[model samples]
Target: MTVTDGVQRVLAELQRFGIDRQDVIVSTNVRTRLDGLPRSGEREPADSGAAVYWQERTGARRVIAIDHYIKVADNLAAIAATLDAMRSIERHGGARILERAFTGFTALPGATAPSWRDVFGVPPDCHDMAVVRAAYRRRASSAHPDKGGSNDEMATLNAALRDASTELGKPIGGEGS
Candidate 1:
């Protein structure tokens, strides 16, 4: 199956859960360096693919990355596996399990840090401080060292929050009134 087919299958599954396609945001043209690329030979360049983000009506959010070189069958299988895992977590641990799973993965070397909007999982035009703070809390909670998270992850989250605050022109402590 093609990438389009894989995306359609996932979207159709989401629709079965009563999610609108619009609510299931699909982002394309994300170019991540592919592993196992031929380093010393003349070969086709690495794959640049898409990423999908969905926030369930129940507030469970997931991000799935699709490689440009993935086959339709593999993509479909991945979607199926993810759904199964998500359902199991939902059944056993509820939203907390989903939240814990939502800690964004580590970026590969040479990858630039994501923008504040991306870190907050908000639209580029979103400027509401409330929304930014909410996102920051959700992300920071999972990255905090006391919560079994790494120092590096926490540092990144802190940097993102600072950047977000600056972008919104808000004092970190809500002072300067």
Candidate 2:
């Protein structure tokens, strides 16, 4: 399909994650929507990359800013699915939205660091299950799709939890996240 088609599909899917398009500010590789508003004459810096924003002003349950490569064609399916998985945190009222947003960003073929920078901020060297169950779980629950997050995000969390548990020698359903 075309880029416009992809963008439209993405917009439609965002609703499923409880992200209202009205509350969004779109800046596509091809155009900008908030142009009518007072924009700083300055454009995004060279490496800043493209992004999608959703938030309270947009009346969304949460805001998700996704970074992507402009050269590659956009894929709405995975994005929609990811958002759905992430709904647990994005749709509900809470702040874990920050971590989810950062951790879950994807990249098109040629994307760079934004796509690979441990968005979750969890260092590979850091293995503190006690911290995950006690602090991380509480922090993440605020936006978990099951609790208030989107389906896509909840799915992502499920996977991350599984990975963390397997390595830590714990079950996903255990007392920790």
Candidate 3:
């Protein structure tokens, strides 16, 4: 979806919860425009989208942002339901969508690095890092053309094999692994 559309949908969600004005926090799956990550600024991180809040009343002594149990959840429905209840609780209107989060994977201990190939679901054999590396080294050398293989074949195989090896070195999961 377009960024503006995403923003609108979120705003509608917050309004449905009645947290559309006083004070609110919002977040979403960051896009290329959010951080200027892309040379063209067109890449969006839709895979990661979420938001939470710490709402406050203008002069209420004890501000209750307790609706977090309703929102700040994992998927869209919880957000919608929370917003609906929040709107019901507030009566008129209250907050707005604030910001969007980004798609990121938690770095795990010895997590194999993601391969460009993995985005397409190819797995590299060998769980041990050393073995994987050695296998790649051998495959790349044999695939090289100076030894007599076609340059096209060598280039294709060696590159694919190398890419797979690099991916195997790290863990998968774009984010939140």
Index of the highest-TM-score prediction = 1
* C-alpha RMSD by candidate, in order: 14.2, 14.6, 19.4
All candidates: TM-score: 0.37, 0.33, 0.27
In candidate 2, what are the lDDT values of residues 1-177, reduced to their tens digit? 444455565567767655666765545344333542112233434443334566754444443444454331243334444566666555574447676665556433543332111424466666766554454465367557658767766555555655566777876556653
Write model 1 residue lDDT over 17-113, tens digit each, in one string. Answer: 6677777765543222243111221232334344567787888787877553444334444674566566666667777855555444334465568
| lDDT at residue 54 of model 1 (Cα atoms) | 79
**For candidate 1, which ten residues in a row score worst on lDDT?**
36-45
Whole-model alpha-carbon lDDT for candidate 1: 0.64
lDDT of each: 0.64, 0.50, 0.44
Give the alpha carbon lDDT tens digit for every residue of 1-177 in model 3: 344443445457655544544344444444334432211223444354455453534432222222223222233344555556766655543333211111122244564354534422334454554444455456556556776667765555544455654655543312221
Model 2 spans > 4 angstroms off: 32-49, 57-72, 75-78, 88-177
- Specify the poorest-scoring 10-residue window by lDDT in model 3: 97-106
Q: Could you arrange the candidates by TM-score from highest to lowest? A: 1, 2, 3
Off by over 4 Å in 1: 30-48, 66-73, 88-177
lDDT accuracy of residue 46 in candidate 3 = 39
